[model samples]
Target: MWRCALPPLHRYPTVDELAARAAALAVRSSGDVRLRRVGVSRAGTPLWLLSVGRGARQALVVAGPHANEPVGGATVLRLAERVLADPRLTAGADATWNLLLCLDPDGLRRNEGWLNGPYTLGRYFRHFFRPGFLEQPEWLPDGADGAALPETRALLRLQDELKPFFQCSLHGVDVGGAFVELTRDLPGLCRRVAHAAARLGIPLELGPYDTLYWPRLGPAVYRIPPPCPRDLAAAITEAAVESTWYHPQRHGTVTAVVEAPMWGVTAVADGSPPADRDGALRTVSHALRRDARVLERVLARVRPHLDGVPDAARLLAPVDDYLLVCPGLADAWDPDTADPLRPLPPLSTAHLTALRIAGGRIAVRTAGLLHQLVTRAGRDPAGALPELDALIDGWCAGYRDDCGARWIPVARQAEYQARVVLAAFHLAGARSGESDWGSQPVVPMHRE
Candidate 1:
């Protein structure tokens, strides 16, 4: 494995800080780096496209596609600095690097409150702001031409312009373990990334969670599943099609999404079969159902008060989506209907439980957003604030007591993310027979 030294990071940087760093790097590169304003966000924030190096093949790295996930922004900045410092990293990959930093500046600004953090669950949820699927640039339906967000259009324009051979979208979870999703199952990629994460004291997620239905290539690595017929139909009609799906179909781009965790827990790392499979499944299912109900009750009460409030629909869209889809997810976990031939790993319980808590956090966050909207509109929050606030506090305390979650340092998370991306970049080059991948060192930023 190639080792790179990344500068230790104490906290996550804000969107403006990341933008400034990118600009500074471009200025310091003496014409080796170029920065351009690609497009403007929904709220008119400038979308930046930072280009570095030159090669036969092109690679695109996108950070902060999701507002709640900011680790990627740091990864992109650090990786850009490292590449500029050591041109051989991209030179050996035989690829020019194009990095898009902070795709959702509007949503990211709402999340800045806890970015440079105490890294606690409570603070994160309190300041969290994840837009609904309809608002997320990365998952807009493929045919929604007139409806596409400006950020989405910018990314689409980049893909068409660069026609990148390799893409890495940096993403992370608030808790659980680290995993990677690939558009193509490149041999040994998973092993290398999982090993690197393990070396960094990061747990490899072997559980059924976000990529539950995806095809697993190895521990913690999954191939992005193709859109099902139903999903394709929905996309043609109204639903969103994820970027992971859109990239490969349009450009045959070998995309890798690296997911790290802010809080690491061992439960997601354990691969042993669950002792009480049915019990674990039922427990998680019950939690999801309860969370959905709680959110529903709160939303029903606040819906009338939010009828004409500005930004109310956008803020409550996630809650509405959750209430609509969460019940089906709960029902799908029916232990009685589970495939007996294929059992879940022990991590399933912990991973599913973490997801449950995440659901609760979303509910609380939605209620809080609603409360703000109602208050601003000169209407009462209908006594929902106290209940939601109590839930947040209770879940935070319960999570601490149950999981013994460890705060994965910001630097460590970035380092692991950098390793995965660099390794994948190397693999992409090797597969293309463009360069001597064996001789290329995986470079990372060192502390000044």
Candidate 2:
């Protein structure tokens, strides 16, 4: 096990703080570390990229692709610091590290209200901000109708320049066990990464909601599925594209998405087949439908007041997408309508169901942002705010009672994520047949 203590973070750092730290690290490093301005965000915040180590191969680590998921930002800083302190980490992988500190600074700044601390579910939702699907930099499709955001373009430019052998996008869950999504199935890699997280006392997410359809490599480790025809058609209709889908084909980069959780519950680790699979599926489907209805009602009430509200379209984008597609999502979970030839869907566990229910937080976040927009526009939300607040409150309470969700400390979360990254880095190096590290096993690193 590659053992090292991750620096304890009392709270999530702000965008400025992250930038300053990256600058400081580069300045203090001995020529091996370099920092550069990659691109400017839509809001004019300069996107910074830190290049650390001088191995033969190239690897890219991107953090904070989604504004609400800040854990990755912390992971990036920690990884950069660790590799700088012990170059052997990257040397073993035979790779130079290209770390993008934060991909969505504008969206991250909107989420700063809850970044500092009190990592409670309620507070996170209160200050949460996630851009709409098309608004996300990473998921932007190539040759889409509209121009790619500056952040996406910056990543694309880096991809062209480096054609990295390995790319890891750090992502996090608000409430669930830890999991990972890999672009390729490198033998023993998933198990090694999962064991690293498990050693840190982080429960493995057996069936994460987002990767439910993806093929499982091991416990909590899934293979990122290709963009389905349905998804591609939707992207075409929306004039959007997913970069992850095309990046592998274009660059032959083995992409790995490491997902840690701000909060975790034991139920998510349960992999026992549900005794009543159809009933469990129906229950989850019904809950999703119910949440969608609540969001639809709130959107309908607030739609009239949205005129002239700055960013109203962006704020409502997710809500609209959720409302429009939620019914289909719910139906997909319905066994009656499920494809006969498709493998059995992930069995619903209490934590998996709760994670699905917590999807309502997106609606809650939308309502909160809409309230601000409406208030700024000098118009009332017509009771939408209270309804959404009630919805969030109910979800939080359920998270506590039903799912047993507990806040995972910021440092521990970062440690688990860093371990996964290191393991993947070594594994990717070995898989590339460019290094001898594969001959050495990834010994399990336990928390001391």
Task: Write down the TM-score of every candidate.
Answer: 0.89, 0.90
* lDDT of candidate 1 over 29-57, digit per residue (tens): 77767999999998899999888887778
Top candidate (TM-score): 2
Clashing pairs in 1: none
Return the lDDT, model 1, position 202.
Answer: 89
Find the 10 residues in a row with the least total lDDT in model 1.
232-241
